[model samples]
Target: MSFMIPSAIKISSQFDAGNIEVLDLTNPQDIQLSIRKDNQSDFFQWFHFRVQGAANQPLTLRVLNAGQAAYVDGWPDYRAVASYDRETWFRVDTAYEADTGELVIQHTPAQNSIYFAYFAPYTWEQHLDLIAQAQQSALCEVHDIGTTLDGYDLNLLKISKPTESEAPAKKQIWVTARQHPGETMAEWCAEGFIARLLDEDDALAQSILEQAEFYVVPNMNPDGSIRGHLRTNACGANLNREWETPTAERSPEVLAVRSLMQQTGVDLFLDLHGDEALPCNFIAGQEGAPHLPDTILAQEDRFKQDLAQINPDFQLERGYPPGKFGPETFTIAAFWVGREFNCPSMTLEMPFKDYDNRPDADFGWSPERSIKLGESMLYPIHQWLQADL
Candidate 1:
């Protein structure tokens, strides 16, 4: 009698920004898996995991609960990202079956281990590294504004070039990203923006720093990010929706940042994000807010036009239609800030999938592109400030 022994294959998701639930791993060709929901919430979609002991072997990963996720439309045209060195992420073969409600990923690992995610993940450790890097520049100041429910620090970066003479007050520019923890592209964009702002040789950056001060929150929901939640913090509160009336227990992140904004007084505000369904980059304004002035509305239009001209990746044609928020307008961060400060407050949304007009087959809507878009934003900002003068 002869007996066949099963091969050893292991899967894990215990690291930072990792979320998955394994069902069956007996057969690498038919591995069964499911995405874990955010803590204390029903929303599930973000997934990151690792496969070990499977070098040069064909494998298939199936998420059985993909259809029940927060955004079903995000699956149809989506391709999952994979990495070997964790530094370079590339797109792999992915398909969605509507009937079975399954998301399938097929790949043959060239090495012994591989990591996969909904998109290229920006880890919590990476966030700390970014903060530390920014603080090394004499132009940047780091502040521990508050703490999350999970006992993590909430950090804010203030960047400006000091002048010896008593010049007129500079414009206060506020930029924040990653209010929804799953949208990792937002933080990536923030990284690029911060890097260019701190560049000593860049003429555009130096010119902007001479006239304006920057207040940036690179990762707004660290607890949710580390916990692998899609849209909420430790206690299941969406920070964006809590801007109108934030509390200490439910959303201390928003409470701390919003209080600081009130104290500092914003001249221009931007909240960065990633849209699950949109395939192109665009901006969504606060047109739904009550009592919006003509001047503020015109300023928003001019800023959009300037950005569209500066960055080819950004467009003006497609986005959330006007009045998309309806009665809940004030609850949103952009809308609340626009109404409160009467400035050009906007949400810059990147796509999870490839940009439809100019898609890259190997790497779709990647971190490099996000970072370039962030660097490109300085041009429009400089133009806006120059026009005012």
Candidate 2:
């Protein structure tokens, strides 16, 4: 027998083994792991652990702690990622046993060391690398949108128009991610979008650069992400909720972004995020915004219909309930961006749970799908630019 060490799984640097409370691994066939907060319930979801001395063996992982977690329903149809090299991640079979709140992940390793995560993780180091790449591109401009309270740069990458002649009609399109820092998949999707946009061979990207300017903020809440917080900033503020009347004290991130939108006069805005509870990929728009003209509504409808046609991953059905106008909290996405800018803006939500239409038992809602969805977004957005705004 070949001797192999299985000490390969490493959680994203933001989270620690302290944050991960391993409940039981008595069953070699079913190793159990759990997440932990300092004083909270046993409930956990984000998990990263290593397996040593188990080469060429069929390893089964059972993650216990989903029962009391925030979105327990998500686990039933989820799959986890495993990587022997930490670069190429593939899906493994995961089964959520409802009776005991256990998530069962089964994998046969050819090599001893393998890493696993909820999805292919886009770590902070990778974010820095992305920023470096964007800064080097000839057509790209990179800068700090602002600094988070914890002093992390809210990086903004701008890809300008390739030619001076195309300036007059060129529109500004904004895509931002990680409002909820736990949604690491959003960043991966953003990375894919940015990479595709910068590629010279990309026809859609070429068209977009000629007709529109792209502004991307790949990490909106670096503080929260580094802190391992679920849905809030370093100050415990939910950045998504502070859109309408964002103040510096409560949400400087929103304040900076809103100011930028005002300065640039946004033609399009997409806030990328992952849904903890939802099981589908969909765009939530400002359907009930007060005084939104029929023309704009038609444009929005066309955008959705066109996107659904292009990609099987995105659907118009199974999204949040419509909120009436002037309701500050409920109408955040629809009310503020649409009514204020009079531009097409949307909250594009991916699922923490599996895509109900096409479920993967091994890798539920993986990063590959998220990146593909991001690519699909370009088509619908291009449609919006070509026809409406």
Q: How close to the true structure is residue 140 of candidate 1, measured as C-alpha lDDT?
A: 99
The regions of model 2 sitting more than 4 angstroms off are 1-19, 24-32, 37-44, 56-62, 106-109, 162-169, 324-335, 359-364
> Tens-digit lDDT track for model 1 on 1-389?
99985458889999999999999998989999999999888988999999998999999999999999999999988999999998888999999999999999999999988999998999999999999999999999999999999999999999999965888789999999999999999999999999999999999999999999999999999999999989999988988999899999899999999999999999999999999999999989877667888888888888889989988899999999889888788999999999888898999999989898889999899999999999999998998899889
- Candidate 1 C-alpha error for residue 108, in Å: 0.9
Superpose all Cα atoms of candidate 2 onto the true structure and report the RMSD in Å to 1 decimal: 4.0
Error of 2 at 139 (Å): 1.6
| TM-score (C-alpha) between model 1 and the true structure | 0.97
- Least lDDT summed over 10 consecutive residues: which range in candidate 2? 10-19
Give candidate 1 misplaced runs (Cα > 4 Å).
Answer: 1-7
Compare the candidates by lDDT and give the number of the best one: 1
lDDT of each: 0.93, 0.74
After TM-score superposition, the amount by which residue 362's alpha carbon in candidate 1 deviates from its true location, in angstroms, is: 0.8
Instruction: Give per-residue CA lDDT, model 2, range 121-159, as digits (tens).
Output: 666777899899877877789977788888878888989
> What are the per-model numbers of colliding residue pairs?
0, 4
Candidate 1 residue 224 C-alpha distance from true site, Å:
0.6
